[model samples]
Target: MIVTSAPRTKQILREVWRPLALLFVWDVVVTVVYFVLPFRAPSLPLTLFGSVLALFLGFRSNSAYQRWWEGRGLWGLMINASRNLARAARNFLPDGEAVDLKRTIVLRQIAYVHALRCQLRRQSPDQEVLRFLSRGEADFALARTNVANGIVDGTGRRIELARSKGWIDTIQQSSMERVLIDIANAQGGMERLKNTPLPVQYRLVPTLFTHIFCVLLPIGLVETLGVATPLGSTVAGLMFLAALAIGDDLVDPFANTVHDLPLNAMCRTIEIDLLQSIGDPAPDPAAPDKQGVLW
Candidate 1:
């Protein structure tokens, strides 16, 4: 989603600033209380709490990143599946109907990609998808609740028609069906990732721990650091908050943010590549400035 490297530093800083501000406020409060009150140094238990909190934050961040990476990888498999399906259609269809059937099936595959992208983003399927289907077909597809499913249904109809017309053998039809099944499975996997989220209770636990650790850090350092307890506390708080905020930011991969997978771009790629493979004119490449940086 986010394209250039130039914006990441600014983005991370913006994401980290809110928690850092809280940390600074906490530090100031602790410093003032240290001088005003007859408070002794924090005990060894406080130090251990801070260490454990840091480790917990690290683990949470890693888990969030893993989910994000896994989601992207699943979409990568979808792209490959779509391409392979088009190639198989081109290769297996009878010679007389090869060109037309190849173009039709490949275009339908492209439409499926676009529809799925829109579905994941929770956007309406647009006119762009209509370009791949006939007017009656497009209107019929629009009647369905799930545009992606409609695309798959249309693909199956076309394959069945081709078989009835003697354009492909039963064995070839089965092969194509297998490819379609793979595409369906890939879509299912993506939907699984999109619908199921990390448990809220699980997320909240580490968050509470991080805050508690930040609160106790000043007391732990007060004896040795004295007036510099605020600085030490601020440092520890910033580190903890950085980990938490980053983890929070990476947990959702299909929320249609700039940080999420470039599904639109990937769909366009499938469309152009499949068309080119069948001797059709390729669509214009997307603008260089708009290209996304893949993780």
Candidate 2:
């Protein structure tokens, strides 16, 4: 999602401001209480709490990163699968009445790529996906709840038809079909990542604990830091809260966030690869922007 050389300080501020604000508010409240009833700093073991929080944050970050990595890996597999399918189409099917059918199948694979991207992001595939399909095919895919799955089903059906008509023999059909199945597996893997979220504890527990530790941190430091407690607490709170925010963003990698996989660009890549194989005009691949962000 976020592909910049460095995320802007302003953007970082935007993400952690809420927690920072709470830290500031809580710090002020606690400061006033500190004056009323001077704090016994050593009474609260800040070191022990900090260690526990560190372990939790590490676990949470690792979990979210795994999900993000899995989604990216699935897309990598999809890209390879698309290329394989295109290669098979050009080689397996004999050039004749089946030419149109081969073209349709190859083109629809592009549609399937775009459709799956849209599906995972919970977006309408109207403009992007429809263009890849014929009027009738587009209309059918658009009407369906799971457009990507429908397109894949159509692909399998086309394979069957091509086999029955002897455009491709059983062996060729089976080989091409194997690539289709790999693509399907990649699709299913991404869909699972999109549908199944990180566990509830992963979502809630660390965040709650992080906030608790942040709020209590300044209180424990009141006696030692005195007037500097607020500043120290604010900095510490922002750091921990920012980490939590990043983990939260990464956990749902298909939500089309800045930190998400570059699905649009990746779909375009599949389009260019498959279309080029069929001697069709395809768009040039795009590069990351000047800041090396948002490719």
TM-scores, all models, native as reference? 0.89, 0.94
Clashes of 2: 5
lDDT of 1 by residue, 78-123 (tens): 8888888888888888657456777888888887888888888788
Q: Which stretches of model 1 miss by more than 4 angstroms?
A: 1-7, 95-98, 284-295
RMSD of 2: 1.8
Instruction: Tell me the lDDT of candidate 1.
Output: 0.78
lDDT of 2 by residue, 124-165 (tens): 887777687877877766778888888888888899999999
lDDT per prediction? 0.78, 0.84
Candidate number of the best lDDT: 2
User: Whole-model lDDT for model 2 versus the true structure?
Assistant: 0.84
Name the 10 consecutive residues with the lowest summed lDDT in model 1: 286-295
